[model samples]
Target: MVRTQDLTYSYDARHILQFPDMHCAAGEHWLLLGQSGSGKTTLLHLLGGLLSPHGGFVEVASTRLNNLSASELDHFRGQHIGIIFQQPHFVQSLTVEENLLLAHQLAGFRPERRRAHELLAHLHIGHKSNVRPNRLSQGEQQRLAIARAIINRPKLVLADEPTSALDDHNCEEVLALLEREAGQVGATLLIVTHDGRLKDRFHHRIFLQSTQA
Candidate 1:
């Protein structure tokens, strides 16, 4: 569902990421393991269509991202890509339901209140529907972020340092939540983290430094 050929990136005239090829199939859960500043997060940004490549092609859902205009890219990203950042950025003034509703509406998709609630319920945090993000714990906020990402039922989900801030128990919970939820929606999972602890859970591993990272 996602493929890249000759992908390379740099910053301030210094090479940061350089991968010639990588492919993520539909329904596959990939764990991107690497150390900080090793280009894992940079790669995730490219995968999510958040940053344009310095060189080479990036294709997500079979669409060549390099060929898309700014508006087109934004539209395509909102409709096809789901991103869960290390920090959950929600509208503090909006309730949990409204935050998700905004994602749908901005993408030109109809907001389904019931579906939003169902997603929260699926995460076992449905009780926070009426609660704003300020009242939730860090773990609860992360769960809410996951719900928002999949609310559009995106075909690809990209997570950046998802388990970085959590304790061991919360880390496992977040990982399980990501796996089960991605599977339920038939979305491809591409997670980027330096934590080697996640390696055993996934078989298709992409080590950035091992091969042109």
Candidate 2:
């Protein structure tokens, strides 16, 4: 679950971003819609504990992110939050399976190769398990990213512009995968995107408006 109150951030005295109070219950799916400069990515980072808010709080899975130290936040995020960025980032030097195992190791859990392979199989990229990430096609890479995100069965899944680069068919496919996979683990799913095409896909949504609008 997630809850935010009076969340505000600014780079300087002249500019500020204010976010609406929002809440998502356990296992709920939400779309965070906004235009560019509406603080969608900023808010996502705050929610993921990647950025410290200049004001207010971001709570996830009942933990107040503002209260955590940098190291603690990193650990907590690894264990509880799964983030899918607009561009998938991976350890190119490592094979797909190795990269997933790294996630488990970073989260302080014992590596489970069987679980990792099962996720890759579920994502339809089982054959790419031993291949380096760079060799995969775009769609395969995307699916691999999904596999990595949910591999830990995180409590909260946050995706940033997940469908931005896909065609309609791929867009729908990715969204369905995200929803179904997250739901399987009873995780709360929140996607932050400016894509209008996603507006009708999710029943719960929050709009981040540009302060200058």
The candidate that wins on TM-score is: 2
Which 10-residue span in candidate 2 carries the lowest summed lDDT? 204-213
Clashes of 2: 0
**lDDT of each candidate versus the true structure:** 0.89, 0.91
Predicted model with the maximum lDDT? 2
Off by over 4 Å in 1: 210-213
Cα lDDT of model 2 by residue, 1-213, tens digit: 899998989978778899999889999999999989898999999999999998899999899999999999999999999999998889989999999999999988899999998889998989989999999887778888887888888999999999898888888889999999999989999999998888998899998789741
TM-score of each: 0.96, 0.97
Candidate 2 local Cα displacement, residue 168, angstroms: 1.2
Candidate 1 lDDT over 38-138, as tens digits, reads 78888899988889998899998899999999999999999988999998889999998899899888888999988998998988888888888888999
Candidate 2 scores a C-alpha RMSD against the true structure in Å of 1.1
Residue 34 error, candidate 1, Å: 0.8
